[model samples]
Target: MGSHRKPRPSSGPFNGRAVRTVLLAAGAAGVATAVPAHAATGPARAAIVSDSVFSNANRLHHTQTKDSFTVREFGNVRSASVRNQANAASVACSVDDKCRSVALSFQIVTIAGDVHRLKAVNVSDATNKYCDGCQTLAGAYQFVVSTPDPLKLDASARRQLADIERRLDVLTRSTLPATELQTRVDALAGEVNGVLKNAVAKAPKGHDRPDVTLHRRLDGWPGH
Candidate 1:
């Protein structure tokens, strides 16, 4: 028998820029996934992202591409994933490309139907041990997502996590005036307590754990 025909090449330079772009959800539900033992509480619901290619100071020209694949749908929102879904994305001609890939993760604690969260985000397969362009820049973030935690995360999940965590940190720590700050801080405390209560409610009838750790900070990233 003849060999199967090869697939046709892409229309353009694989256009990774289209794939590398970031995506957000309006109101999404996540796939169930297992975290580290210590990470059981405070599942990330948003992502933060940073890459060697991004620079806010110098308007560098770069190509980016992204694709969001819906994994599951809840209410009107669909849980989706993103990553290097395209090829040879856009970027400044002067920019030095150092990283091959990146990834991040996040967790959210809901209080009174509102969400308060934390995250652990990271990037890997960097082109250089250190990237000059993106150094001192914040990493990305995303939801820890309730998906199955395989031994390693796939590209879509990794980048999603990195991007969401990077963004969520800002949302969590956004400063405000003293009066509003106190109000928000108290609101946050209530959210944490809400998560603890939910966990307790689901515990086995006789299970007794005096203390619960609400969040697990992923190491080696900016601002812990």
Candidate 2:
């Protein structure tokens, strides 16, 4: 008869603790392989904001939630262009509809002759450093070019002059504080210089000639 055979243990000589450690390591490796390496998220971006002012018989308010945008200023804008209508369930985009969105871009010649551009979306703000709302003096005026109608030179010039004067009056009487008025004061000075160099003199004098601005300290930002 053959000698009695001894049964060997199925498990190796490794201790229970070591075996558990190996199993845990393998589980961790499997988890790592299942996850995607590029599944990381980026930092959140800041909200883009601008202080807009406009009127068309009545007034309009709009909002844009695009990543980047563009703009055009001071022209013969129409009311139909601004979709300030009912339920307005769609997005009103800017002049450039590259985003394939509903447009909200509008141009209006104020009674004072100041051409105003209001775009709830798409139109990019004039910035200095890089993107919208990115600089100390960054504004939504990247396309603030004047489209003058030579036929109405005297009329247009007088209107714009009146706008400058009105802006000066409102700014001077603003109560917002000096910080807000500082830039406006600077802007007023620039307007005064520009209107003088260009076409205000040819126009007749009257309320249209808003030359004298009230030098009052106000904090209300100019709506014009």
Candidate 3:
């Protein structure tokens, strides 16, 4: 009878721990591939909210208008354009119909009476979208003033002038009554005139001081 050979033992550097580690790495890669890109991130943000007061007015068909004025002063002549424009925002529109917006504006104009021409120097304007209730919008402004000779004012005077202008701007957007609004306008005009008067007094002899004029107007949709 032939003799049987003994079985040879397996040989290599690989062990049971090494095989388990390879299997675990392959399982992790499979899990990562199954997950979606957005799922790995977070949820999206919500939409922005609008102003409640303005939004409510927009839904209703109510309309409102405030007081306005215009003033022109040159040399020794002072003229004004003032009227009651309470119905300025009134229009024939309902909730289903298209409505008009309200607007307020101020401008400074220089008139070349010799050539019958006019040039607008400074302007401040404000507007609100279609709304039924009484609403006031802040003015977006553009200011450009021309002086015969460049104005040179001390720091204190300049600060006072700036403060007056700020007050005038605040009054423009105010919800005050017609008389009150007119009063504030007149006072503000006086303040501006005071500053100009000082500048004119300090000007050198034989030099003509620049004449400043103020113009204000209110515009809205529909007839008033």
For this target, which candidate reaches the highest TM-score against the unseen true structure? 3
Off by over 4 Å in 2: 1-153, 200-224
The whole-model lDDT of each prediction reads 0.26, 0.24, 0.31
lDDT of 2: 0.24
Worst 10-residue lDDT window for candidate 2 reads 16-25
When sorted by lDDT, best at the front, the candidate numbers are 3, 1, 2
- Model 3, 1-224: lDDT tens digits are 12111122221111100100000000122221112322322221111110101111233544332222222112111111112111223233444543333333332221111111223322222233332333323221111122333233456655665676566646654556534554566566556556655654564433344444443332222212
* Structure candidate 3, residue pairs in collision: 62-132
What are the TM-scores, per candidate, against the unseen true structure? 0.23, 0.21, 0.37
Query: Which lDDT tens digits does candidate 1 get at residues 1-224?
Result: 11111232222211012122223223223533323423323334533222222221112422221222112111111222322111111112222542111211222211111223333332212121222332111212221223122112245444553443344334333433223432333343334334434543443332223222322211111111
Candidate RMSDs in Å, in order, are 17.6, 33.4, 35.2
Q: Measured by C-alpha RMSD in angstroms, how accurate is candidate 3?
A: 35.2
Model 2 Cα RMSD, Å?
Answer: 33.4
